[model samples]
Target chain A: MQYIKIPLVLAAVLILVIVFRNRQRVELRAGSRVLVLALAAIAIVSIIDPDIPQAIANLLGVTRGTDLLLYLLIVVFVLTSLGLYFRLRDTDQHLRRLVRSLAIDDAIRKDGPPRSDADLGPDSQST
Target chain B: MESGPTRRNDDVWVIVPCYNEGPVVRGVLERVREHFPHVVAVDDGSRDNSASEIAAAGARLVQHPVNMGAGAAYQTGIEFALRDPEAQIFVTFDADGQHRVEDVMAMVDHLRKSDVDVLIGSRFLGTVDGMSMSRRALLRAAVVFERMTTGIALTDAHQGLRVFRRSFARVLDLKAHDMSWASEFLTRMSEHQTSYEEYPVHVLYTDYSRAKGQRSINSVNIGVDVLINKLLRGR
Candidate 1:
């Protein structure tokens, strides 16, 4: 069996970047399990038949199967990071609104609710 | 309690963001309460007795259930204060006993007299007490960085003391949850074309504040957050 060096290196880097997210996050636990299974199957098939990747690489005008895998891996890694980053930010924003409303509601409840007249006032920040 | 030359403006609502500052916050609030009749303090999930201290100081207390950053605390306090239709001016103060009531009074006066939308307190333009050389250098670097990045011509990069008209606050929304909020505020001011002025304000750097202040390394995190956020906005 011939040694494939590049995909191993690419996979190693990919593993290092996203391993923590797959392990400790309960928020994404359900989705990650399915992702793990799918990735495992793809990795297995790619390892079992290197010629399949080579043929696809030839179709895509790539010289080596490992190089194509590396390119795809880099693209996937970046896309995953960007998607997760924005999702986490959105979740944070939602949590902030939740906590803020609870705090403000508690304050208003005890301190006599703000006069209802101001409710119809033109407050542009409400948007 | 009302002995000093109180600029007791009922139209002004002072917003204090209190985080784990149980010991020093009461004194700070007391000083602030002397000048301003209306005060809103948001305790950002303090582990200590800051909430009770704020209540004891007679400031309206808003408590976050969990620890949000100082920026979020300020936003919560501002939104709470904005509920009052009578409130015409809004002020942001630090809970670390740094900001002076006099500086706030001066800034509020400036905001009221001038046509500017917001008045930001600048220690470099005034006096910073007990600041170390290295911290001063870091802050100056931040000012330069702010000017280069946002071109707002600010003398100070991160200061808690600010006064803005109710009109400005009505159109203001802050997105950053942490130290990056200072930059977010600047960007918003520029984006909205909000007229602004810098007031010479005094900042006291005590041993307690030194312990509580952010580390220089945190600037790296703020830079990354702002950069990625700007990218996400496609600007």
Candidate 2:
């Protein structure tokens, strides 16, 4: 192992141990953490042994190892951006429901509720 | 012929989703209340005095604290109306005064007399007072898209004036929180096997309405949103 890899790998392993021990419910966060750690490990390993990524890249018909990493970075960036977008959409939906209920509750409080079904029509009376 | 109880206007709830159209909303609600007394104007975080305008028009106001889109506003209004065990019909009207209350009256009458569960007001089937070429083209393209995707033949797809019975509103379950909700509504209508028909109604475009209405370019955002939503939903 290279001089820089020694401390970096040890730190990564320690962080992974703590994360694995702490994660139980938040599967999304845990999965993302694992993916980030895996990527970081690969990056550190590539720095330590430049020929490994180059050999893999050559086998895959790529001329350079850094080019392979670039392509992967593009893919990972797109995936992460899309994941954030979907989460934002879900959070927005929840916010809408919360605001909607609050609006309805306040309206009922101020307006004294909608008129009863007796005088309106047969529809509500039947229900 | 059997005698069925004629539906009254008090049972219909007109859900006017107002954003910043403070100037014209009160006038529209006034005309709407002339025919249908129970009008619920949903104020979608308008910076203007639309809430007071709604109150001034004698319509009940349900207000969003933050600026949710028109779809969210309409959904809030629908939910608020649904609370009243008395509400039997739900009408989604624009607050910018493009929609005519006369058309609402006619559509409500048609829905009551017929077996249709939803009456969608179509400008193509009726008349347009003033329409730009690009606006008309965009609307036509949206119709074609709806036709190909949902296989639901409609002359107009994104018209804001829609009247549906309370029974349909109860199970609407709209997911889109923005203008994309229009397409989502059509999508769900097919899934629900709703008995729907298009009614010819006049749509008049004014300077204020044009300024306040959505840009046709937002259709691109709506398309992406719908596609991504479908993909994420895995349906």
Candidate 3:
């Protein structure tokens, strides 16, 4: 039990460290911050007592406490991965737009205005 | 939106998005200039003197701070061209010289006479000289993927040559900043319900173009990007 508790505590601290480290960059919303903190608390309590998940699992008709925790962890993992994926995509689009706008601005500054219609018209040259 | 100063006569501004085509860009611009002097070449942060070559050729040159990709460069050129009220017609020509000057003239003539808002150059419909078998198959596969994604049946879905009118330019808001934008352009045309026509255009496959072109495996990335863009943007 002590051996199990050691690894569980280490995992929780590692998750907290990661979340904190990336909190600024990820721009986690208020709700997400609260949810993460709550998840961390639950993880700590479950590691210490080892019965809370079992009780909850019993109410939910699950056979084992570990199984319930594992299932929950899987759900959390998927959700987190999806959240990060969306964030990365959003950042990529924002950056591309920035670069595009800069390029367009440069073109406008250099060219000033478009050429006259007669000058650029098809009548100007023949293939 | 009511009509304003944005309207003008049919003037063709050739938008050439170049990336490190230093060796051949000068000749390509010279040929294009012979027919259409109103050219805007967007240099996508080439390490070589591509920008200088474009400027020396007497065409308007736009430089990107970094290599954003061909799609972004196209958007920049389009936006720049849109600034001129007299710039009614916009032609997208490749800087690699694969596209002929005659094709652009034909497309512009067809576009003005026809009712379509956009004209796409089709290599399969016309002729692809000196094309490799593997490249031909890849382009065929691209057509399938494009039809599946955009629901617009095009013989050559990835051809860089196109003629877009003034009205179409206002509605054409391209978001793809990479090679995948070619596929996205078709999807946009379909999604916007813009009328388009595919015209036969001759494509000259050269050794330089073959080496400088998009790799075959990059087709997978384009496919995935198209899927993701369709799902996210619903286009």
Candidate 4:
């Protein structure tokens, strides 16, 4: 138990530091900031008294505190990463659209307006 | 025989998104032009001579610099049409020569008479010749999935031929940039409460079209895309 406490506390502190550093690059919303704080508080409490997480896990049907924390952390990490992945994909799509639109605009300008056949008598075939 | 009164050809825009279909797209454009002269073909960065063929066919051509996907091409065409006040009806047609012009005419006719916002061509309701048994099963599964997610029981949820009124077209800002757009379109239709009707339409599944159509395994990817879209939109 003593050996596990040192590693767990170190890991929790490392996560906090990484998250703090990430905050400089990404502006954490109020809800996310509160969530991070709560997670940090839980980590600190669990490191101080390892039995607390174990008791809660026993109540929740999970056997071990480490196992429960690991499960929740994996789930949250997966969901958050998925969310960020989707956001990055969407931004890429928008950027691609912007570039495509620019290319289309250039083509349209060079070829002239893509008017309907009814509007084009003889000049529309120039493109 | 004429079914009902249809809108004038001048007011409608036939949007065909062509990608590496240089061989057949011109023929499709010509057939569509016979009925509706207002045609726009968005060439999705085809390395082939599709742009030249589409331009030669006399359809209005919008060239994307790279392959942006069919949904993006449709968005470009719809946006282009909406820029003009004269464009009333927007019909999304395929470049693979599968969709029939008569079906589009009938859909436009229905749109003109009914108060519906859009008309979707249902191959299940009509004839879909040469469709493999596995493909049919896949399509049926897709219909069931779409029904479960969108609460809209469509006979052919993945059909490419859809006619949208200018108003409804303006309302539908499509987000999906791939084959998933077909499924996402239904979700949006449900989300916007867009009044839609399914019309029977013949689909000629030629060897070329079957080869070009979506593979059965891609259906799972489409389902995931729809789920992600719903999640991202917080719906």
- Proportion of native contacts in model 4? 0.21
How well does each candidate superpose onto the true structure, as a TM-score? 0.80, 0.84, 0.81, 0.77
- Candidate 1 docking quality: incorrect, acceptable, medium or high: incorrect
After TM-score superposition, the amount by which residue A34's alpha carbon in candidate 2 deviates from its true location, in angstroms, is 5.1
Task: Quote the lDDT for B235 in model 2.
Answer: 21
Pairs with steric clashes in candidate 3? none
Compared with the true structure, what per-residue lDDT tens digits does model 1 show for residues B176-215?
A: 8998888888888877889998899999888898899899
Cα displacement (angstroms), candidate 1, residue B52, comes to 0.7
lDDT of 4 by residue, B1-235 (tens): 3321122466788889999999999999988877776788999899999999998898888888888888888888887777657788999999999999999988988899999988999999999899999989999999999999899999888999999898888877776788887877788789889999999999999999989988899999999888756644632
The candidate maximizing DockQ is: 2
Q: What is the lDDT of residue B136 in candidate 3?
A: 92
Candidate 2 lDDT over residue span B1-235, tens digit each: 0223224476788999999878888899888876776788999999999999999998889989999998888899899889878789899999999999889988988999999899999999999978999999999999998887667889999998999998899888777888988888887788789999999999989988888778988999988876655544432
Sort every candidate by DockQ, greatest first: 2, 3, 1, 4
Residue runs of model 1 more than 4 Å from their true location after superposition: A1-50, A58-67, A114-127, B1-7
Output the worst ten-in-a-row residue range by lDDT, candidate 3 chain B: B1-10
Score candidate 4 by DockQ.
0.17
Which residues of candidate 2, in runs, are more than 4 Å off?
A1-34, A116-127, B1-7
Write down the worst ten-residue block by lDDT for model 3 chain A. A118-127
Q: What is the DockQ of each candidate?
A: 0.23, 0.27, 0.26, 0.17
Q: What is the C-alpha lDDT of each candidate?
A: 0.82, 0.83, 0.82, 0.82
